[model samples]
Target: MASVFLLLVCVGTLLGSAGAQEAYDRLPSKFKLGVDMALEMRNSRAGVKRLLLYFKGLGQSDIQPGNDVTYIYHNFYMKATQCPKGTVDTSNCPFRNIKPEIDCAICYKTIAGKIQASPKPYINCIRKPALTEAMKRKRVNYCNEMGYSSGAPGGLADIGDTYF
Candidate 1:
């Protein structure tokens, strides 16, 4: 009976993970663009501290239509990393070992799909308390997959420098 129960638990875990992957795969590209824009906005405001953050995941999102523009609201997560603002290679940077933050923002894009730099999308991020042991353990699997990102897509353009 114990062995049977273990098998069922494993199977359930696999199914749950597969479902999550499928959902992510089906997410609209616009959702990803919103998340990317949110990340950029957050990094831009990371002033004197130079603290840089990486995308964690989206908690919630919604889109509203306007006359000739669309508002994409996003509530997402970002993990603080040891990498600073100018870090050229973030793939080697690990998390700061602290609790991640939840960022909320609303991005305005044109009907033609260009993000408006003017109305500067409203963005705010708040870091929670430190992570407990269990919370850290729960994120172990994400560590390996967290590699590859070397800061925002166009580099630190906020500082007036662009990488090729």
Candidate 2:
């Protein structure tokens, strides 16, 4: 639950997506043994303090008395993932059940390339689900543009593929 919460707060800040079409533009990558929360936050365009405050405010109520944090996180993840395809706002995302819908972009990030190592990095809002052959080709191109050699094996993925 802690891992999930931390991951959510940090990754959530990058949810302002522009779709995966241009992930090839930035094509950032990182390598490490495990999640380096601090380093990631430091590298974000959004100030780390801002994201911390934002997520902290959002997650405070998640830990309730006698209610396992793990359970809360699991439920959130499950319900959000099951949301209708193409949903931009997480109105039904269980993260919030109120009228004001939250952004689904929080969970939709695009990663283009075969991970050369652990702690794979991703481009912000550059990849989308390729529904056709052409889309898949775009993903391959994204990977190639990231400095991958011919047929070196790389592709596109989203935050959904990373987290939930």
Candidate 3:
């Protein structure tokens, strides 16, 4: 009975190791998938908004101007301008009409500085290379933890064959 139990333990260990190796093999492909997803997200308006919000909320107050203020200001300006003059009587104007008049100089300058200071969100506005790099690093670490080589023969394909 003891010998049977030992044999079972060895088999379980081997299976577990093989499963781990298989997982490692798939890491590159998973990394690529993550990168592709990020790229797709970056191309979308909602995705851009989410990323901007994330960066803005991460205590990167500098990015808040561009991500929030500038965007909101522009939208407001456009909406206000869309209404033809005299279309709505000013006597009943609900909100103060500061459009095209107030200048919003401080807000504009602040947003401009934010835009200039950190252009990563803009550059990543289309591709998100930084996110891709982060994903790559994560996959490398995961592969290492699984005792596998990310640069193994056939690269991602080898992992796909075994796992996916």
Candidate 4:
């Protein structure tokens, strides 16, 4: 009886841990072009910081320091567009729609491409303060041009506000 109780306890604990890990994995860990653009409009500084953290947390073998940003940018775009939407065929949508439910893929792709094309020579460029500042300015300008203001905090708040 003691051994059976111990086994059941261990099984329950393992199952709970697996469920928690799955929930975490379901959260966005890659920089999505549309999501980043929305966050930038809300708060450029926080947007870039979150993007940097996501990149840093990725598996080393998945992305290299010198990897082409354009490639990553493209991957993000593809992922956003490919994501299913309430049984709708979103692939035909002009803009890759994220939260707030709107089409704006053209703008997101253009800005993401430009950022990827820019030069970055500093070590761990994503972590460099100057680089982040520059990215913030660029993102802010892009958002402003599209008529979005810095009305809200970014990071988890932005995510919750937009999605939840």
Best of the candidates, TM-score: 1
Model 3: lDDT to the true structure? 0.26
Q: What is the lDDT of candidate 4?
A: 0.29
Q: What is candidate 2's lDDT per residue for 83-149, written digit by digit as tens?
A: 3333444322222222222111111112231222322332222112313445434433454333233
> Which candidate would rank higher by lDDT, 3 or 4?
4
Per-residue CA lDDT of model 4 for 66-125, tens digit only, reads: 323221211111112222333233223222223222221212212223333222211112
Off by over 4 Å in 2: 1-46, 50-141, 147-151, 157-164
> What RMSD does model 4 have?
17.4
Number of backbone-clashing residue pairs for each candidate, in the order shown: 0, 4, 0, 1
Compared with the true structure, all predictions reach lDDT values of: 0.46, 0.25, 0.26, 0.29
**What TM-score against the true fold does each predicted structure earn?**
0.46, 0.21, 0.20, 0.24
Candidate number that wins on lDDT, 2 or 4: 4
Ranking of candidates on TM-score, top first: 1, 4, 2, 3
Q: Give me the displacement of residue 75 in model 2, in angstroms.
A: 20
Better of 1 and 4 by TM-score: 1
Per-residue lDDT over 13-131 for candidate 3, one digit per residue giving the tens place of the 0 to 100 score: 55644443343344433222322233344324442221111111100111122233221011000112222233332222122123221100000112332322221121122222233
Pairs that clash in candidate 2: 20-126, 20-127, 23-126, 114-154
Clash pairs, candidate 1, are none
Greater TM-score among 2 and 4 belongs to 4
- Model 4 spans with C-alpha error above 4 angstroms: 30-164
For residue 82, give model 4's deviation from the true position in Å: 38
Superposition TM-score, candidate 4 onto the true structure? 0.24
